[model samples]
Target: MKYSIIISFLLLTVCLTAFGQEKQSRKSKNPNSAAAEKGLIKVSVMYPFAEGKTFNMEYYETKHMPMVAGFLGSNLVKYTIEKGLASGIPNQPLPYMAVGTFYVKSLDEYQAAIAPNRDAIRADFANYTNVAPVILVSEVVR
Candidate 1:
């Protein structure tokens, strides 16, 4: 049940994001430009939604993410934090309350850099959210 909800949320999010991205990507004429795809690795941390869960968006955005990005240093290409708004089922709660993702040039580099800071990152979770986060790592094929 849990995994299904997460999967559903992920599918919905990807479909929406990819729709807009397809049009924008077609306009990029430079093959060797800095924005060109380099097969980036994506690391996403998702917070599942529950009836009584709590999430402090302000602290997460203003402090936690900045601190993490600094710890990642140059290995972190970019990051995004998304807040859930609606679900496929009318009046149903979204599967995830929040999702944070970071893009890295290499998966190995990301693993090495995050190893030392893992404890610190985990410790900071209490400051913003009561729900435990689920991590998903994948290669950006396109």
Candidate 2:
């Protein structure tokens, strides 16, 4: 009888463990899980400064980024703007005047959100910088 009770207890414990693992797997499979678990894609727009070029930081911060946020809405998880200070090499010119990074849950979401608004966004570029912007889309691994 004691042996039978021990065997039954072991079976119950195994069943509970398996059930808990299945529940965890289901939660992870959920689309609305934590942002880190979902992975992120970054879109970087870089503007290289030239000696005779123009870049309106005021308009970019005041107007352009706001418009971008409006268009992208919730799909734009977050964003950051960085002003280039100087190159690590002493006295060297900065490679880029400004860099804007936009993060989203997935590339597909970014493409969907940006496709329709591409022309509008491009039109605003002239108001901010004369330099042609270099765009890079990459996945965040870490």
The lDDT leader among the candidates is: 1
Error of model 2, residue 61, in angstroms: 0.9
- lDDT value, residue 66 of candidate 2: 81
Expressed as tens digits, the lDDT of each residue in 1-142 for candidate 2 is: 8987787678767867998999789777974545463468888999997798888888888899888877777888888888888764444678899998898876787788889999999999989888989999888764
Task: Please provide, for model 1 over 23-132, each residue's C-alpha lDDT reduced to its tens digit, 9 standing for 90 to 100.
Answer: 56865655464445458888999999999999999999999999998888898889999998877554467999999999888888888888999999999999999999
* Per-model TM values vs. the true structure: 0.75, 0.71
Judging by TM-score against the true structure, name the best candidate: 1
The local lDDT score (0 to 100) that residue 73 gets in candidate 2 is 74
Residue pairs that clash (backbone atoms under 3 angstroms), model 1: none
lDDT of 1 at 114: 89
